[model samples]
Every structure is written in structure tokens, then in C-alpha cells.
Target: MEGKESKTACSEGFSSIRLCVFLLALLALIVLAQLAQAGISRIWAVDDGEKVKRIDNNHPLATSSDNPVRDGSEVSLFGAKNEVSANEDGRFVVLPVENPRYRGNELFRAFENYYSPRVRELRNRYGLDAVVAGETDEWKRILLLRHWIKSSIAIDNENPTKTRGDTFAILDAALREGKFHCTHFSIVQHAVLNSFGYVTRRLGCGPGLKEDGGHHGVNEVWVNKFRKWVLIDAKYDVHFEKNQMPLSALDIRDEIWRDGAQSVVCVVGPDRHPMKPDSETGKSETRPDTYRWCSWETSTNRFTTFPATSTSTLIMLQDEIFKKNTWYRDGKPHWAYGTPYMILTTRRDWIEWTPNVITSKVTIEDTKARVFLSSCTPNFRSFQTKAGDDTWRDCSEEVELPLAKKGRNCFTFRTINLFGVAGPEHRVEIVYSLDKSEPTTPGTLFSESFDDGKLLNRGWYDGDVFNISADEAYLGVGCIEYPWEKGHTKPSGCSGVRHLFEPTEEVYLRCYIKLSPGWGWTNRTYHPHLMHFLTTENGKYHGPAASHLTLYVEPVNGKLRLAATDIQNKNAPHGLTQGPLRGGYNGKLYDSKEVLFDDSKWYCVEAMFKLNSLDVKNKRPNADGQLRGWFDGKLVIERTDIIFRSADFPGMKINQFLLTPYFGSGLLPHSQTLWIDELAVGTKRVGSVSPPDSSAASATSWGLMLERINQHFPFTFNGAADSAIVYANLKELTSP
Candidate 1:
């Protein structure tokens, strides 16, 4: 059915491609000096180094036939050597002997072929070389170099493959792949500059460990014109859009010298600890000490050692492993959390798989108790659980499915326990066989049907239908009457679970939504209560009415925008009575921009509300005021701060929240409703919202995020919080 809509949303927008755009922009702004022969280029001597006077005769630096190349002067400092090659032209590029290999390094080849080509093209087109000429020669070079590197590569922690010996291979793969770690970029860029006859070396440092323990590396280039090593970080260029420093920005106190390539830092020795397990149980009388390799700051070139154990993610891997069990069993893992521990824990939903159902017998077992659990409607072949308890017992009831209409079957833990101790306990398994002969559906739908009872078979379908998606729990129903349409007054008729959020802290309710076909609307006399399931009893005291955040779903700029106000605060202005409006603490909308929403795509929408206003430091919020939103991944509105109290600007606190379908007039209806997943509410302000991970997006930028978050540390050690000390230290410097 056609529905009335607002004016179409404006399309003028600027999308952000962090890694790609940054790299391109950086490349465009580089200033490579092109000095003609005989030009007098300025070369400065270091505090402790000697300078040489050369004859500047007009000629091409590359093809100066008359000038004899002489070893005029050299300076050594740190662990690198800086040498300026007097090109035919008086101007020169710095050549720092960085590693064992001279000039031609693996990284050098990748840059010349892949990165430099694009950079040269961009530089020529932008004319940036001219814009940066007179800007404090040192400052200009630094700025240019910083921009080039920051935008060129995306930073990552772990490389896909295990290879790590050569920087060039790593950089080449990363640049080609559009993502890499800082170390990889440094290696590659060093090699490329070397190939260009420019000297390059590694200036590595770490956190005040030994010289090598610092674990930091940046490239140094010696420009004959400058007579010093211009420090540049190829890694920073590869991973970021804003380089931290420039080439001419010198911070070294002493002269710098380059050494053949060596590890930035490596801890050679091992530390041993007494072998003490939480439980003391060993058959042998002689118990050996346990030793785990940890990073250290040693005196060698490799100072700050980063243990492989600390860098890889074990959590995500464990999560993948957990999903395998689910897919292998009931077609999905029944994931939930335990209270206290579970309530405070973060939830990670795994990628959903297409289902292929085959004939199978179900089994139940409690691994913790080492016993098989009982079922309610269990058939030797098929059934679901409805009872609560111990022992491996199949339900007395038996059921069967038609050979046709075999969809992936899933189970929900209703009366089952996750811990196998208290509450309801149950563990179920299915056994079936896969049939490759069957064709798969081309959408997120059921794929195959297994008729055997040996191994569980699973397959998937793909489609664009938003009704069924990878992130949904497929609930099936036979030819029963539409429960809501049949006027079923039971709470279960609404089906959707009511989640009551009691303020561990105050929260804001924001979401992107669409309604089901024929979903009813509300009139003045009738309004549906926003249900809050606060108790596990299912039939216990329902939360009080009027405490929920009142919401009305309506069309705003051709998209569904949920307009909510601070209804919990009784002191604010009342809301408009008609056209999808509800009462709450109203604030001025002096300037309201259009809201963006995707037709079928998921939009990342966020809302933040102040929880208090009375206490200055930690005051109770008057109303949730700051209302902002995004569509796809672009910010659409910067709503005027929702001021609750007229006296204090933008004064308001938030309480109670809700998400429900429209209860107003049904005249302006939507053709297809929306499905929502990944709903988050926070009291803290959300700055940039990341788009959902999809294959269509560039994976290189993922490297940048990986480098920043260092998610690897948490995932590697399971429950051990100490796996990521490096990340922990790094995060401290940039903590918000």
C-alpha cells in the first residue's frame, strides 16, 4: 500500500574513507625538491659534525658528466650513518645506510611499483609542492612528509600470514592489500627510498626500556641539501592520515648514524616461575618450573620485546570456535549470559550461517554434571525442551516433521540452565547428514534438508529480503490465526521480549525501525503500554506504567525517525498532542537538520542523555537532551542541545526509555517496515560511529582500527586480562 511521506532527504554529503582518502591526500601534498645543476642548496652541519664546501655548477644532478664524485664528508651518530650524495645538481637526497642490503630493498620495490606511482600522479595534479614552499622550509618538509605517510597506509597489528622476517614482503602485501602494521610500512618505505638512491635508516625506540626495548621504529633520510638525516616514519605514513612529525623536525640531541638492519627490539632470555597450579595434582614427585616467554627491555638493539602471545586475539577465536559448536548442533548457538558475571559482561554476536536442515535425532547432555538431560516433547527423531532438571532423559512426548519444508531448526533455552548447577539445566545436540545434491536459495533463507541421523547438516541461502536476515532468529508458526489480529489479549501475543533497563546508570533509547504489515495504530482512548520485562518469573509484577520513555514512530524526511522526549521529568514543557508527538521535557529546535535512513540497510543511530542535573559533578539528569543521529555511517543531524531548564542552557536529565511502533493515525503508512539489530545506548558521548563490517568495504581501514584498539591483547589470553600489557601502556597515553 502506498503511504504519505515527507520531502525527500537531501543527498549532498561527503563520505569518509579513512585509509584511502588519507593516503591519497597525503600523497597529493608531498614536496619533492627538483634542484637544477649548479644551484646553491643549503646544507647545515650538525652540532658535532663537520661540513664541506662543494662547487655548485649548473648541471643535471643525475647526469653531471664533468664532476668527479668524491667522498667529501660523513657523520656518524646513534646507530646510523648519514651521507649526502652530491648529485650532479647541488641539491641532494639523504642516504642513510639502514640495513645490510644497500639501496634496493624489498620494500623499496613495492613503493616504486605500487605506492610511489600513485603518489607522483597525485603530487603533479595537486600543485601542493608550490603551496608549501616558503612555509618554514623545515616545517614545510615535515608537514608534507607527515601528510604523505598518515594518508598512505592503514595501521594494523597482525598480518594475515605468519611471515615476518623481511619488511619489504610484509609492506608489499600490506600496501597491495591496503593494510599493514607500522613495522611493515617502515620496512617497505625504507627499501623504496633506498631504491631511489635516497639513503634510509631505522630510528627505533621504545618506552625507556634498553635501546632496543623501546620497540619504536621510524625511517631516517639524509638530504645532501640539508646535510642531516631527516627523520620520517614510513609506518606512520602507511597507517594514518595525519603524520605525527615532519622530516626536518629534528629532536635528536647527538649526531645520528645508521646500522645495517636489525630487530628493533628482542628479549633473548627467559624468566622462570615456580610451577603452581590452582589445584595441586601431579603424578611425578619432581615437578618442574613453568616458564612463559614475556617481552622485556634488554640492552641489545632489540630492547622492547613484544611477545607473540600478547599480540594475537584469543577471544574472537574462541567466539568463532563457540559458533562452530552452535552451527554443528542446533543450527545456532543459544548464547546468553549469567547474572552479575553475565549482566556486566559484553555480548558478542557471531556471524549467522545459512541453514540446511536434514532428518536427525536429538540428544541432551550436561557436560559439567556428566549426565544426559531430559526433554519435554522429545521424539527419537525430533522435538524441543520444555522441562527443567538433571539426568539424560528424553521427553516422554514424540513429534515428527514432514519430509518437505525442512528448514534449519533452532532451540531456545527456556527452562534450561547454562551453568548446570542452579536455574534450569539442558544441553542438546542434533545428528544428521549433508546432501550436496540440493540447490541453495539465493537469500537469507533455509537452504538444505538432511534426512539422515548420522551427522548434522547445515547450509545457507541468500536474498535481499529484510524480513529474514543473517542476524535474526527465525521463528516458525503453522497455520494458526494471526494472534494479535485475533484479539489475543495475552502479553505473549506481542512476541517481542520486553527488556527493562534499570539504571545501573541512565540511558538514552535510540533505534532504526520499520513495522510489520497491518501492525495496528493507536487512538486517543487507547495506547499500548511499552512493556518492560524486569523479572524472570514471566508473570511477576509488571513495571509501573508512565515510567517508560514515550515514543511515536513517524516519517521525517521520508524516513522513520523516533521522536522521544524526557517524559520522566515532570518539570519540562508538554509535547504537541497530534501528528506523532508525545509529552516530555521539550527543548528548542532552533535548527533541525534532515534525518538520514537507509531503505533496507542498517543505519547506525545513537542517542546520549544526561542522567542528572541537580548534582554538579554527578547530578541527576533533568532530561536526555543531546539528540543526534546517523544513517549508513554519515552524521545527519547536530540537533541543538535539548535544554531542559530555561534558566541553565541545555539543562536536562534522562530517565525511562522505549522502542515501539507508531500509535497515532495510520494514514501515512510505510510499505515495508525495518528490522533492527545491534542496538546500543550509552551515557557517554559517541564520537564516530563505525559502519558494520561488510565485504564491500575496504579491509585496509580495519588495520587502522586494529592498531588503535589492539583488540588482539584481550582475545588471546581467554579470561587472563594481562595478555596485552603493551596495548594497556599505549592506551594510557591516549586515554579519554
Candidate 2:
């Protein structure tokens, strides 16, 4: 009876075990199915066009759009209701319209600091490209760079050099002390990767347990091969990998949690050899415990000026199962752990964002679609676009594509780096309709010819010292004049005119001016402030010399200049980036390469000033503002990237115009008379005055001006390397 019962019990146990195994297999399938669906969704969200959906919720992704959809979200495309979707190939996708409720809140700017001129100079000066030139594999190149830095600088934690994140200074110190800390290693590594066109961020790691004390600084670089961020510990010349795939900080932590560090492989040196146990410690170089917690610096470019700690930091923690409040002592946050000012996010996507990605916006009007592309690509070269079956064509960031058909219009965009590497393609589709209104033109805000010989009647103020003379005029018989006595700086008592209008984001001023024969230049860097614009943030009668925001359009040392002085903003939080606080003046100067002004000849001068966009939600300023100058219908000075104001003045506008020409106190060279005629201001270009008679003297004057320009500044004209080409073009345009 006992044998029979035992056999029966054994059989029942086997049956139960089989059932459990079956259930486990079924659960695994379900999980795999869900993961597959998620993967498909991610691809659709970024790559494919068919599954693209409007982000209606207040998710972080919504911040990428200027207009985010909210409650009762509905998007209209080509007079149709929200019925946009991509075709089967996913080659084209429809983008949502602008969301009015969405404020300008962006995780990253259109231009990242990795591509700044400073970084480019650093790369060239250090020959960073040649460091990895021989390496064919991208991963090998990264490893090679790590090894190079480690071999060059020795580790010295006890007395690390205090170079404060300056790569150049750190390298210079490396030659003397020959040692530094992990922070220095990571700083140099981060900058080197950026110089090579790889986006990177400094990572700070610490132990999770309170009893465990110590910290380590490393770097996480974006590797296009794996399409993910990989951890590179330059201090120890090591990296973590699993199944031949490089691992990130979070990856290492998760691997330790799953089983042990047995599966995690430690890769060391450019040769990609397995790391050996430390001679003294008898432990692996990569301590998994050290990566229990991780944080990244917010700005990658701030390392040159100061340590990453000076800028905002972002703490990234795992999911709830691993997260612990005990990480903060007494449940009180710490800067090293986490603080109120520091952003703490459980989402890994926020920390491991894709680099060198193209962001696009599409606007459809009439039979045309305007696609505006912006990117944070390092070493960005140009944007390439393809329409329908057309081959890819290199185009500007903003392009207008024609919609030949009424149905599906597909467009694909990608950004190319300086190294010829192309970013992931962003495909978009739009449905077009021929029924649309024509684009409207901007209207004139204010115009003055002085031909009326009156000021008060034409919306002019502060013109007490103004005199309308007929001595010389570009078009009309009357012109405004200001006379100076010999050795007298302001004998006319600051003679000028002011015009006030409704607040405007942009304004264009056009006028014809002629200086007295043998007119003299200030010869100093600054002075002879000619035309100026004051923002609405300041009083209408505010002096342009020192005000909240004063944009100066004048001649400095005979060169056309577009400058800004915001002495009032000297103490603002963002003052440092704008200009320096020298004594009581703070401003930035943008001068033309060629001197566009000459004496005793009427010249057409026009200037356009546009305010930069502000990320109001984040209180950040964009550097897309423009200041353009035209000399006799030819573009002389063009500055598209400028920061005119900070977020503190969100409502600022160019409301007041000043035509005050003054040489700084006692700085006027000599007595000279300046005359202006046919002055006009409007929301659009006011057009230029016709050239004077095409006579031999007129041609000679033009030739002399060109010669003087070349003599004063011989290198290039507005960054163009071929100055001869520029002169040739100018000669063709100005030929009699």
C-alpha cells in the first residue's frame, strides 16, 4: 500500500510541475508581445509616419512643439478635420498644426553648444580628428579616445589640478603634474568626444546604500552604432559591456540587480581587452556598486567656464522598486544626491536622449507647404530633403516645397554632419488643397521724407533742434540736417528726432544720408551713435546711450555697425552671456567688414532689426534674432544669430526709433555736417533710394570706398573666405 501511494504522489507532483511550466511559458509570450507592441509604437512615434499621433497630454514630449494640443484636441490639415495618417510604407506622415496653448518650453535648443565656434577651435587646435583617424569602427574610435586620454594624464585624486573643467588648462597642467582626478578625466573625455562630433555628458555616480561612501565621475557618450548612450570611464580606461554590446550606467545597475556582476564584462584600453583584477584591491576595476545612482549635468558647454556643478544638474533614478527616499539623508535632499533646484526624473528617456536628431514643423498654405527644420546636430553641415520620388537635395533649414497633387505629398529630411555622417531621416506627409488664400504683405508702420518740412505733424517728437534743409537730398528737395562747430562735440545740443509707434517685434528703417566733404571718423571703437531703436520695456523718452535695451545702428571707425547696449540688464541673471559689465556700460558690437560710408555722396542705408524668440516657460533666450544692413540695395552687414533681450523682458518690442547722431563726450573728431533724407520705417523693408547719377566721379567714389574697405580689412567680407569674389560681385552690382 505504501509503494502504490508513493508512485501516485510522484505522478501527481510531475503533473503539477508540467502545468506550472506551461503557465510560465504563456506569461513570457504575453510579455514579449507587449514589448513588441511598445517597440513598434516607439518607431512610429519618431521614425514611421503612419502611427504618428498628436501628443495631447502634458507629457515632456509636448514641449517640443510650439502649439500643444489640449482638451478636445483637434488638428486641421488642408481644410480637413483631423484625418491625417501615413501610407503603408511609412515614408510620409502628417504633422499636427500649431498648438496655441503650448508655450516655448524645450528640453534642448535648435543649436547645441557642441557645435559652437569655441568647440570647433578646440578641436582644430588639438587635432582631435587625427586622434581617431585610423580607427574604422565607431566604437573602436571611442575606445581609442578613452585610452589616449588615460595614457596622457595620470590619476591623482588626492591633489587633483584645479583647472575648473577647462580642457586646455587641464591639458597644460597634465604636462606638469601629470596627474588629475576622475572629474578631470571625464571633462577632457567629454570635450574630446564633442570635438569629434559625438554628443556626450558628464555622469556622476554614487552608491545607493547610506553606509557606502564615495563618488565617481565618468562620461556617457552617444554611439550611433548602438543607437544608445554607452558608459566610458576614462579614469580607469574601462567600459562595461554585455553580449558584445556596450552598457550604460543604468544598464550596469540593472544587470547587478538581475543577478550579479558575473554577466557584466569590463572592457579596458583601446585594444578592447577584458579588465583584470586590481593589483592592490584584488577587485574588478568596474565596481557595479558605484553605479547605484547616477546624475548628469544639464549643459555640456558650460565645462569650459566652470565645473558642471555650477550649472543645473539632473538626477536620474530607476523605477519605484529600486528608488529609495533613504538616498537622501533624513528624507532631506542634498545637492550631491538631489535638491529642489535639481531635476529628478525616473524616465530614462529624459536622460538618454537621442543626439543629432532633426526636428521639423510644417505649415500648409495654398498649393505650397513650408517645412522648417531645426536640429542640435554637432558639426551640422546642411539639411537634405526629398520630395515624393525626387532625389534628396541639399536645402536650407527652411524650405518651401510645392504640392503638385491634391492627395498625399511626402517629404523626407535629414541633417548631415561635417564628417559626412547623416542623421536619421525624418519623413513627413501632407495633404494639400488648392483652395487657400494668398500670403499677405506687411504694412508700413511709419514713413518720413522730411519733404513736408514738419515734424510734429508726422508722428515725430523730441525734434526741437531738428532743421529740414534742402542743401542735399537723395529723392526730395528737403532733408534733415545737424551741424557741428569746430572743436564742439554737441554745439547743436544733441539734435535728433524720435518716432513712437505700436509695439512691434520687427522694424526696418531706410534713409539716404550724405556727410560733409572730408568727414572724419571717431577713430575709436565706439561713438558717433547714428540711428537707434528702444524697446517698449523702457520709457519713450529714455536715452539710448544707457537704457534697458538700446539697439545702435551707426558708424564706428568708418565701419557700419549694429550693436546693442543694455546697461540696465547688467545685473540681470543672464547678463554674463549678453555682454560684460564694464564700468556702467554693457553691450555687444557687430561690425561690417567693409566701410560702407563715404563723404559728400548720398548713400542708401537700410537696417532691419528683429527680436529673438524666448522660451518663456523656461526663461531662456534664443539666439535667432536678426540684424541686417543694406548699403545702396546691397547686403553689407547681416547677423542672423543675435540675442537682443533676455527672458526678463518677454513683452519687449521695438516701439521707439531714435535718429540721434552723437560723438561721445569730447570725442568728435572735427566739425562736420550730416544730412539725412527720405527716411522711412515700416514692418517690412522700406526699399532703397535710387543711386546717384552714374558719372565718372560717382564711379571713382565707389572705387575709392572699395579700396579703403580692402585696405582697412583685407581678410574677408562677413566670413567669406574669398574677399576677391565679394569685391567682384560688388563691382558687378555697382558698375556704371
- TM-score, one value per model: 0.24, 0.39
Writing each residue's lDDT as its tens digit, candidate 1 over 508-583 gives 3333343232233332233333212111211222332222233333334434243443233343343321122245
Q: How does candidate 2 score on lDDT?
A: 0.64
In candidate 2, what are the lDDT values of residues 524-638, reduced to their tens digit? 7888888999988889788887777888887777677888888887677776444877876778888888877766568888889999999988999999999998888988889
Residue 502 displacement (Å), model 1: 5.5
**Clashes in predicted model 1:** 86
Candidate that scores best on lDDT? 2
RMSD of each: 38.5, 32.0
C-alpha local distance difference test of each model: 0.28, 0.64
Q: Model 1 reaches what TM-score against the true structure?
A: 0.24
Per-residue error for 616 in candidate 2, Å, reads 69
